[model samples]
Target: MQRMGGASASLVLFLLSFSAPAAPIPAGFVSWDVTFPGNSGSFDITNQTGPNASTFPDTTFPITTTLHLSGLGLTVHFANGSTVVEPSSYFTLSADGESFNGSPIAIGGTNPLPTSATLTGTFSPVFITLNNGTTQTILSSFSATISPSAGTTLADGDFAIINATTTTVTGTPEPGTWFLTVAGFGTLLGWRKKGLATFRNLLERKGAL
Candidate 1:
């Protein structure tokens, strides 16, 4: 009976280990939450920027580059009331992290909109470093679009004067993590089956089954 109790306790501990929560975010990281028409998410960025400020050609506006980010949790809410937790993807900053310039992961799809129309693109080569020191590609590609309302204007031929009402972004996780997750579940199942069998045999021998 004592041995069976010990085995049951060990099995419970192993199951709890698999169901443990994620690690907490480190200190000194700034948290941000953004919500648009189609999706909402939260992320944490390093509080400081790079040492040197970058500037555009023929302009003197100093652009401070953000250092790094982690804990990027995103969710995509579809029109049919379905929601998907988007994988953590690498985000780039242009113009103080508020704008994008021709990159595939552009927040607004494009920097300077010559005309008001819907633009579509994808986010490629997106990856994030996990807390375990493993670099994983949480998101592979995305389909996004941006449409400007009527009477939108450009300021000094540099910035766009428009409101981003709705934007759609989507992505999928890489296969490596998925495989490991499946394998872990399989191992847990095997352990559970073996433990139950042993417990049953002991109970039968002791006339308790």
Candidate 2:
């Protein structure tokens, strides 16, 4: 009866060890380099943890992408600056004395990724929507590419939008660490059970003496 109780206690301890929660995800910035014709720069995507800000999505990182343009001829050359990327939405550009907005071009699949991208083409047919909600189609063109920093992916749904148009990226971890962790715990449990059995036998021999 004592040996059986000891074995059961050992099993409970093994199960309890595995029940501990995983490590917390640390806060970090996801940086990317955005480039355009005759201009290049970098930006960061980070969570908005400030007060008085809308937290509808609950979990979202704001990306502030900026560009410096000069060679592209417009009616009036405005100072180069950053464009506020609407979270999970679009961004705006200026050309020919007017502003045009577009969503990030999906590279790998249908979703927007944080991986590096090189856009080199005229974003033709960008229409300007009027105040009355009527869109006026115009001739437009743009080309640029973006690439993400280390330990990032273009397919992370929590950080990115993954779809058919999303581009594949390297450094994507496969067979995630969870599997390895569980396997390790399983092996440990087996060893612990054997050790406890040997301890029970030792105790029994001592009692008999």
Best by TM-score: 1
Error of 1 at 159 (Å): 27
Residue 62, candidate 1: alpha-carbon lDDT? 23
Q: Across residues 1-209, which tens digit of lDDT does each residue of candidate 1 receive?
A: 56445555655554443443332221122222232312322232323222322233411212232223333333433333444454444344435443222212112333232221122122222333323333323233222222223344211122211111112112233464455456556666766788889889999999996
lDDT of 2 by residue, 1-209 (tens): 56456556555554444443322211122223233312322332332212212243432311111112212211111122222333312323424222233333333334333443332222222332222222233223332323333444322222212101111212222353345445556655766787778888999989953
Query: Which run of 10 residues does model 1 get worst, by summed lDDT?
Result: 160-169
What's each prediction's TM-score? Answer: 0.24, 0.21
User: What overall lDDT goes with each candidate model?
Assistant: 0.33, 0.32
